[model samples]
Target: MVLLEHPLHGAGGREAGPAAAGPGARGRGLVPGLSLSRSLSQQQQPRLGRRDFRLVSSLATTRKTAGRGWSIRALGHLAGARPRVGPARAVPSCMLGCAAAAAGTSSPPRCRSRALFRLTAVSDPECSGFWLKQSAYREQPTVRFRYEVLFVATLGPGPGSLLAWSTFPAFNRLQEDRLRVPLLSTREEDKNQDGKMDLLHFKLELPLQPTEHVVGVQLILLFSYHLYRMSTFVMQSMAFLQFFSPVPESQLSMNGDLKLNQRQLLHHCGLDTRYNVSVVNGTSPFASDYDLTNIIAAYWDRNVTTVFSDPNPLWMTGRATDAPFIINATIRYPVEVILYPLKTA
Candidate 1:
């Protein structure tokens, strides 16, 4: 889940314009090679089932708006088959009015025509679960089962997107396990008003295969921030795991009753070229158990020398167009003042 990025490329975007004006953005637009990094932290974020804000096509306006916003169509190779997408959709500016009215503001912000709605992601979208139904039950003699947990993501109103994620719960005949969630890429964001990117569009992978006739299971999702960690564990997936048994040890006893242990190792090879190559093999890492963690860690870790090549040369880019004020244009500070500095006259 190492999403290499430029500072302005984060969902926080450039801190200057109204469209991307938030607390987190420090630079205006993309600062070439200005890298923003997210780390694995000990502190955890809480995840329930439903903490998302859904975006609906505002019915107030007669003009069509539903099929205009962005939606995720491809979830990479790990998400199994791409879910059938219905239509492109977006929420309108009137959302501000409704939000204000609920807040007891004397007068709500008036809706505008040209540009509105800041695209946001919604978690646990029923459609994701429905796709699993099609994959699991619809196909007779189905061996593969897949489920998805959606999260509210913010596609930059002007630029950038922060992709947070949801959970995948799997159950079968009293057997259970968590599937691996792979993030091919991340769209960093600043969801909190604290002024930094705290959100991301983390495309995850949860694919499974059942060995028997499928029995329906209620999928429950909890929100989590650690994609790299949880995906590595891959605990409790019952659909594909018919049964799990631990390996037993045959001990060779020494004179003092001490035991010596030995195990077999598998050999492997992978894509060698750095980023210039088309595919970064084993780009996504997952751990099924402690041993798997070591294997995966060794695989993805640079300098392992056992499999992967050295770390790829980092590359970052920012959009050429500067994000402009789309919300309250009048309140915007001058671009020169925000992005440029003054010297003694």
Candidate 2:
């Protein structure tokens, strides 16, 4: 068990000074109201080359003011975390509300809280393929002020929009990770003592893979405040295409009126699977954007293989490749992919 008198230490902010002790040694006791305490424990056996780690924790704090006592306890495990080594130690960025996503062969767990974010969109008849009309979130003006996002490689296809989500890297080399995003503004905030997180707005841009028509992309967001981190996997999508050979236009922009499955859309977003949402069936090229229409028709109207989105993007039941977010198409064709930025309502 890891114990610290200061909440900052919960995420390994300060090195283990002489005050550090093991489980049976001592656990930090709570103060009436003037101080902060946090406890984080790792349950997994140590592994050699690993960044992802699981933790089991039971946390509670008590304080008194004006002769009135108040306390809160958060038991059970927080979300799973990926670690980052700081100046002196290997620390797990405290993930408060994180959701599992599909990566390579493994499917990590996923979740939602006042601080968590979920995805939702529907097919459009008048625009490009689709538009995200809503994002699932709640408003909370509580919890202490906390937060960087670090970009690792361009996860295939190539350059696209960057996202800042639930948990971010606690300690990142600012020099190495560019894209200095300005302080973000959200519609809701967590300012009071409430443990709930406020709703936040998010935007995502997907990069395109050269020569490939029907591939998928993943969007992972990191949000770090003080010592707390929140990472949410927003999307793992199999996109339909509208190629721009000579005049490359926006990819997956909501300007096109395309339609897709609701459940698949929700699944790609790491949402609950029981949702009944619309899936992409076929294309009705917009009157404008003839170039885009022709491109979509060429592939969607052709003999291209039609695939479907997985009911859920979880590792066990879903594939990282495609179909976890799709449905049978109107015609077999390559779906041009585009990325959409999601906003809070």
Candidate 3:
């Protein structure tokens, strides 16, 4: 006579043999080939009855291969609704069945079936697996800056008694009478050869008349910043600096760091352009668009920004009559830690 048994224990159906009654036979706790049959008969029937039994039987009968076992494939089939083995990830379905069967539970099929569909992705075959609640990472961004300067050189002690110039065409147009174009030399350096810019050297030389003197200065620089690790983030940001003194100065030198200022959390994934707009509207001919007060106010409204932190500046008072007023600045960009949600499949 033939005895039908689960592949988990033995082959399809076969008669008992001498090897079945060997020394380890008792350790298996089975009487010849009738062990699995008796155990299944003793267990309580599931809600689906024979259907659940057939499902388990059919799932277990699939062809096996090397490097991989039957349990993982079976679980993936049931969870992903297909016979394809997915990513090297673990799910709760196969574990539930193994645990239920080992513990002699009343309903192993029912327990496993529920867990099989718990974390399944119906549409995406790649994203089918159980995973942790969340994850994060760190990143450093690539930054490129452009010169957008505005400086004031006073000639006398009155409101409109100063010479000024800016890179903005609109602002320079308004200051045509007092405007003086400066020769700007700017370059970005990657000290570590890591592809990301680390430092910016800015040097500007503004020619002056013999009697003209500079007692105050105001400057602004713009940057096109981007991030690519967690999400694609783009924005136009700026750094502004201003200082004035009663005594006239021949040169201004500054050294500072261009640091990130974030007031809100960034998105875990996808493109973000909330602060991507220009800091100053160069296209607009309106004087308000070029107003320093208006530009700074609009920039402060953003949740993310970059600031120039210069604690001490050097100002020299000795100038030859024919010499030009020089301004030298060094801005450094440092590495940063970013927290983002991890993707799973």
Candidate 4:
């Protein structure tokens, strides 16, 4: 973002006093070479004076016009010629010129007050699987096992006077997917010691079962400004990232006899594998037996803690189950899997 400073006016300089009075001003206690009281007395003196009201009126008009010109110039300088990334457009040069000319005339334009706020765009790099967890099943009936993960982020104070947080609606779902957690909480922190607030946080939650597989995830982040009266200013700063797992393809299928490819496996599991893969499984019938393979990829598992910290702070931890076989042991099928970035508005 660009920030411009305005020059200070009326600083360390001699100011012009009231305009010189004319012949008419003499009648109103305004005159050169005479004290104000004496001038008033002379105007009231019996049978003695001629009043030049037109001359006094002209002086007042000149003073008012000069003051107006000074004010207009100051405003024009403060509102730089360039346009920022907000709703307001740049003030036309012609308009400013017209105002200057008017201020130089006898009838000066009235002053109007206006307020403006600056916006800053900020975000951190995407952090991959920061949390992981896994658990084994004993004799539990409700759930045999569970898996969970978490991500964290940290944001600093903005460079502008006013700061606010807003998420891009189009990228909200993608963020949830990449983080592998439900959007639960958000908070702002004051980190600059400027006696002001600046910072944001998001919390997510996810559940996993021992019999399920791991698949890739995509996420995105958007930044904007929130003004008073429910108004908002959109920004261009955005972030995107994808997560991947290290599991081999041999362990991604249901049976040892299925010839499931990555593409087909992901398709059967309703997942995109080109970008990130969490789980995959496929089974095929061979000449004399059945073959199967399963694939799984993820940043964290039941034993690790993942923290996503950069733009903001997010903590995630979870457990996951191994790829389990399908109920139909002898069935043969083809599977395909692909993962990539999701489209953004």
Candidate 5:
């Protein structure tokens, strides 16, 4: 039995009930040639910690100047028992648009609302997964990345003139005698002691023949990336690096950041595992499945990816004729500010 009033229109204007607002009197709006109508949800007791309870309302106004109709819909969340009736407060315009996405229905061009409603418990900690005890979104993700390495060093620019190695047994099998295993070591560090790794220290030494001289380097590192927030996003991503020089290089040192790259917007709510697949089919028996060209092309086609951003990679000359080509790399995973949409219960 609550009465609602428009802010722009004075108390002398027409009023509407809580449950239903019928067509208002003519010339009810602040505008000279406009009419207004509004409807509000009936009060009800919402089930606690269950499915969401949406308080739906709509306003439709006709404009004589534009010869059009404008519609506006609002959605409020109701939780627990029936809300206690109190003084009504004006809701911001942005909050009114909260239900617009859920409504999916609009009048011609839509109308604006100057109505107000007393918003009670709009969200519940237990139902929204934000404060749940076992919820993944309760804390920062303890990301565990599985890694695989692949490399190709070109001795010369001519075709079939490169040496390659891979951690994949099938890929190594396909390489046959051309396979060159390097001495590799890796270690991860938690800089701030927050139980999450901050960076990885990687070193690799590839033995070379006295006549071999490396003029180009290509490397691929695959990782299983994920985020547990509004949505549990799981994906297999890669950091691809390529460097070429006319002169033979002694060593390559890289300090880079492996950051997430998103092409399409992720879902506001749901589990997203669309890219949860191996970047390279390690168990495949065919050589085409392990082709670098095919792998890079497929990885880029994904909506989400990881890239290695190294603005300054040091390439030192002078191999000393017998020293193995060395690769020293430091890849850091910096903290990122993720903006996630919160759902009203």
Candidate 6:
């Protein structure tokens, strides 16, 4: 735990002194009375005014300053210069009446607090061929707060199908392994009571592959989708896209320098052939696209003099005619892909 010196440490360190007497000091341990004791030199006394006296009095009543040595130097600093002596008075009856009035005992019942439900979708509506509209609350006060909700979806059966899913990376890096999505909450509802509304909500989306059997699409519901909470603060939400695909049996050969035909080269490198090639595109269209052409070329030129150096070069044929070769071709597409930003109240 972090610790710091108390603001009143010096005051509490002073010594205690005998109680002073007279009109300026009266009524030992009584309300509206002055009890002055000095344990320190004048330089160590805490100079206080009338306002400070009232504040100190309130502090004394609240038991915040007791036992902690605090010195009062003079009563002349108080306003009105009134005598300190006073009767041992009971708390005012009117003050007690005021407290009772403010107790809220007779107020009419009302919804004192509100519970909120929010729905957020992250998708490329144009590519996904669907726009999402939440049946839940329309909007919420854009506050920074964390919450959990369920996520559910229904999939149409097909040979090669794509579905929207969400995952959190173990860390911020994209390549890190993902942990299973957490479950938040569950509920059962039957508005019609005919079993038509029966559904199970999930807190996370599960990626499901295509199946042979035909199944009619139905509503998928998620419950308790967890989200970071913020209150008037900016935060970032990172989620992973879950995908399902058939795995290939054989690994592709990365034996030697690869040489691709012009069309294959351009497509693989994500370059528009119509555009002029420049340093921005790198030495080769595909190679430049990934900022890897120079490095791959240098490595290939240095180590392997013939296209037949390895069992199977990526793009180069084993024939001597194809000597100069390319290895890994990486490309960047220009199109921007935007996913919906999830938001909650």
Candidate 6 backbone clash number: 26
Candidate 6 stretches with Cα past 4 Å from truth are 1-59, 62-81, 84-161, 164-345
The better-scoring model by lDDT among 2 and 5 is 5
- Worst 10-residue stretch by lDDT in candidate 2? 62-71
The candidate scoring highest on lDDT is: 3
Report every candidate's CA lDDT: 0.20, 0.24, 0.60, 0.23, 0.58, 0.22
The TM-score values for the models, in the order shown, are 0.14, 0.16, 0.58, 0.20, 0.60, 0.17
How accurate locally is residue 64 in candidate 1, as Cα lDDT from 0 to 100?
Answer: 24
Q: Which segments of candidate 5 are over 4 A away from where they belong?
A: 1-145, 339-345
**Candidate 3 segments whose C-alpha is farther than 4 A from its true place:** 1-137, 154-156, 339-345
**Cα lDDT for residue 316, candidate 3:** 90
User: Cα-based RMSD of the predictions, in order?
Assistant: 33.1, 28.4, 12.6, 24.8, 12.5, 26.8
Model 4 / residue 18 / CA error / Å: 56
The parts of candidate 4 lying over 4 Å away from their true place are 1-183, 193-197, 225-236, 248-345
**Clash count of each predicted structure:** 23, 58, 0, 78, 4, 26
* Cα misplacement distance, residue 22 of candidate 5 (Å): 39
Compared with the true structure, what per-residue lDDT tens digits does model 6 show for residues 114-192?
A: 1111112223222221223221211111111123221212233343332221221211122223212332433333444
**Sequence-dependent TM-score of model 4:** 0.20
Give the CA lDDT, 0 to 100, for residue 264 in model 4.
16
lDDT of 2: 0.24
Please give the lDDT score for candidate 1: 0.20
